[model samples]
Target: MAGRPTIYDVAERAGVSKSLVSLVLNRSPSVSEASRLAVEEAIAALGYRPSRAAANLAARSTRLVGVLIDDYTNLWFVDLVRGLRTTLGEHGYRVTVADMATAPPTENPVEGFLSMRVEGVVVAMDVPAALSDPAAPPVVIAGTRRAAPPDADSVTNDDAVGARLAAEHLLSLGHRRLGHLTASGGAAVVRRASFVEAVERSGATVVTIEHDGPTDEQAGFDGAIALLETHPETTAIFAANDLMALGALGAARQLRRRVPEDLSIMGYDNTPLARTRLVDLTTIDDNSFAVGIEAGRLLLDRMNDADARTGAGAGATSDGHARATHRTLEPDLILRGTTGPAPAAAP
Candidate 1:
């Protein structure tokens, strides 16, 4: 009676079996609504907490997945994780995330997951050369343009198409002198190429396409300032990502340029920042959530394939040599307060 509440105590108090309580705790959809509610109420009243360490030991498998991301402050990854959990949780898998931005320069971040014996790994950041041949768990790359690993799958939005959409929208809004704020990366290259092509096709002048240091607000702000200083005729600016677009907003305010009056700003990724009242940036929706879902689905497929091959006496190393898959989801333009008809004359 003097011990911490356990699942047994919760089951007895709720008048339910331990297995039923476990199912409810696991969030299995098969459990009846009434039974689920009863178990939840009992656990809440008794303050019973499940022992993850004990459960992992008993199951003989961690049922854990690792997600490697570049920056946690970037809200695009937040949606990607939400989508991954939506699908992964249904299969009794839990995700543990690591920020590569904070890792030691010489260490391979994925090693942390491998040491924990994760069932799979999802890479939302650029894949490093050190992790090119991760042998065991299935791998999936999300929201990246890099080619998949030998046996991995990649899911991303079409950056080129999204960029073209942005360009065309700006052109339609009477933007004749346009600028692009970008950073160095494969995705950035594609977006810049498409944006340039669209501007040329529209018979408009591309005033500037600045390659900022990093894809962040500071880079965006610096690039925007540079564009404004060098090419004051630029009426619109399209940033490679949402964070960069926010930087453009700062530059506009600092330069005494009214948004959608003196300059129209466009950002990509349609992150939460773009939708906020303070930073209503018009941008391309990369559909990162869908990309995450696709990555999770592909990883599940690869895992299932491995299980099948193992059951048929195939070796664990065999799947890594299998053919890889590349899936691209479509992106769309989202209109907001940041972008509007170009100014009649540049101020």
Candidate 2:
């Protein structure tokens, strides 16, 4: 009457029970022809339209979204999840994460997510080879390019730009002798490659130490020690991530080099650790929160398109599978106390 008509109004107008009206709306065969006609007549009079969200509810929609990550120790996921949850929660979905490092080998993380009946998935790490199936659920990959499935939408950082920013920063400070501490991963490889190229373009020296172990503090420490010991003239260091940069700080301390006075260090990811008063690490801000928001939007689009193809409650019409989307965000440099002009050489 006052606003949009509801099922309750339709039932009251049709002189039937609310349950019977629902049965008609959902097209249940149990409703008699006479009752169906009565409901249709009542609906035509009131112009009642069912909500897709309500329809999904009646259809037993799961309303859950799963996120996959390699580990929890990486603080970079903190802001990413914040942005992701903000977007998905507004659309009536909850986000759940699976740490692949802790999952048993027998049960694939994707399988675990599917067993939980998640309507969609967001992969913040590498896309596993086992997930190349054609019938896989809707997915959005974050920060991966090479391993991304054909149908999965992707959101990634502009590693070339980010690495260039790092290189230019160090070079601007007169850091001719540079050292890079990195680990194994697609993101790491891209960053390392770009950083090396940018430094090489200026005819500067770059000593890269790639650790075979996990990308953690210890790897950073070991790599830094090796780099500094082998390239003692190296005046600047760039770590792959904030955790590694923190480890580099420790390495510098153990080696008796005063930060930004005797040596300058920079890191990537601009994680919360870089913002701390103690660490104060100069790093590249990958804009991961924005990447997460865009990723959430992309996954929603994929899920909605998939639903339309299967005649789901969400309204849309398309003939064939939707095309995948790929988005990349540019990164910025955050200056802090960790980096400075190259110190005067021993004279």
Candidate 3:
């Protein structure tokens, strides 16, 4: 009946305690159906929309999850976010994504999110030294392989296994001489090391690995050019990621090396670019969506445990924080048109 309706208005009209109204709004199972219905009816009658901040205060939690991504241009994060939302939404949690690329060089994304009092944080990028020692709040590392805080949980694809798969595919396709275009990221390091190991185990000639500054399409392009020049005999190439793989494709075209016909190219991440008709890159699917889902589940569990400990009148939190947990999902090898039998001449 006034300019705006608040929780007090909804509770008054519902003939229930404000705390009861809060429980119903939060979808607490303990709230009786009668009370829930009464709250709902009152909400409709008063046109009362609960503010997010208010709801958070009532729940004694922000219920906000921060997701920090390395770069937005990389399509792998699209599926990751989809999975994150699927799990987080069911539990009434909202996710706010921030790109590390856009953040101030002196300020890390995790600090900024913590300053806002987010309930949990998921670092989807490589672990920065600034976040190497998060003391409070749940922190989960997603899709990355860097040294994280002692208490941090991690959900990531086994990059070494994925690289081994790529190397196996290329070697099985009769590719004796290969090159790997990589960069300075942790994932790239693992992929490169594993790819080389797989190649060496095959008893084939050593593979040529080239690196660039950042992991991007341009880095891939430049690295490919350098690799091709230094190892002109390379019959196949594997990029650290799909973006670099696309660059390798460009290099092939410029060098007049027809894909699969003159050279085979493979990439990691199996991003949307790998599925495109023009690219059709043979790649290792890191199962980004699954990583996101696992990260969400792990973070939720951590938060719940922390809350339970706090409510139990424990003198100190559990030592669970001292022991880090890491989960690795297996990646799939997706074969596409970009890879085939090595050229007859073998470059």
Candidate 4:
């Protein structure tokens, strides 16, 4: 019927056995680099698209989806996962999650998921090098990443917009000098940069203490302490996340600065901690749950498209998924007890 080019044809063309091709597709470390390059070249030449059924060497669907997150301790992902299950559960698909923080230092998270035979993958963290493989599954990235695959769908919040909104909120409170609590990498870089721009654009002064490590509560505490110590005139503080905001709160208490009186504090990601009666932090709602819902929807759309193309050759492309599309949701500021009018004077 001249339906599609199968792995057998690639094996014949590459002058290797079908099992060797499978090993190459799986990115087994046992294969020599030379053989890997040869197999990749053969696949490219023949436009052989590898799917879950093809990679597993079976034609049946797995109905399992892989999810990789940056950190497990950060409860922000809870809403994201719930939103994903809300849509995925109805379709009979289940998710298996892997946390990058807990993964072995030498292991590649993407390789593990591919080996697990997950039909698709959703990444809420950095894009892995292994994801560029031609045999990789359809993928959707669920949050703001600095770089995403050219073929991966992205459903994320606009951190830059949210950061600017924070600037506006603090500026309206008559804060002439401000501080940003941030980390050296991840989405914080973008948020901090945009925040500084917005604050400076409003003719206000902004200083920041950026941590060289993860943006956890410790980083937030340390950063806030440093920022305040150096820039006492800074009347307001904006943290990259709620945990950091909590840390900032601790810094305020330690330094004897009163919240919304001596220092106005704000945070990002309206997580559960932000909603707590004790925390009651003014924060940005990036809508992590909504992002998850859209991510699930995009992944299902990709899967449907991939399934529809089962009988067709991918025409010389390494990636099997369709062209990537990005969806960004607006960010909203949620006012709470932590942030108020800038101090009558910086304490």
How accurate locally, in lDDT, is each candidate?
0.80, 0.83, 0.80, 0.82
- What tens-digit string does per-residue lDDT give for candidate 2 at 30-134? 579999999999989988776675566448667688888878887878778887898887666789988877888797998888788787888887787755666
Q: Write the per-residue lDDT of candidate 1 for residues 205-296, one digit (tens) a residue.
A: 88655664558888899999999999998999999899889999999999999998889999999999889999988999999899888888
Candidate 4, residue 347: Cα displacement in angstroms equals 10
- Which of 2 and 3 is ahead in lDDT? 2
Candidate 2: stretches off by over 4 Å? 1-58, 105-107, 312-322
Q: What is candidate 4's TM-score against the reference?
A: 0.80
Relative to the unseen true structure, what is the C-alpha lDDT of residue 59 in candidate 3, on a scale of 0 to 100? 71
Model 1 TM: 0.79
lDDT winner between 1 and 2, please give it: 2
lDDT of 3 by residue, 226-300 (tens): 888888888899999998889889989999989988889889998987899999989999999999899998887
Deviation of model 3 at 219, angstroms: 1.3
Candidate 3 lDDT for residue 266: 85
TM-score of 3: 0.81
Q: Which candidate leads in lDDT?
A: 2
Q: Write the per-residue lDDT of candidate 4 for residues 131-204, one digit (tens) a residue.
A: 76767888898877756777689988999999999999999999999999898555788899999999999999
List pairs with backbone clashes in candidate 1: none
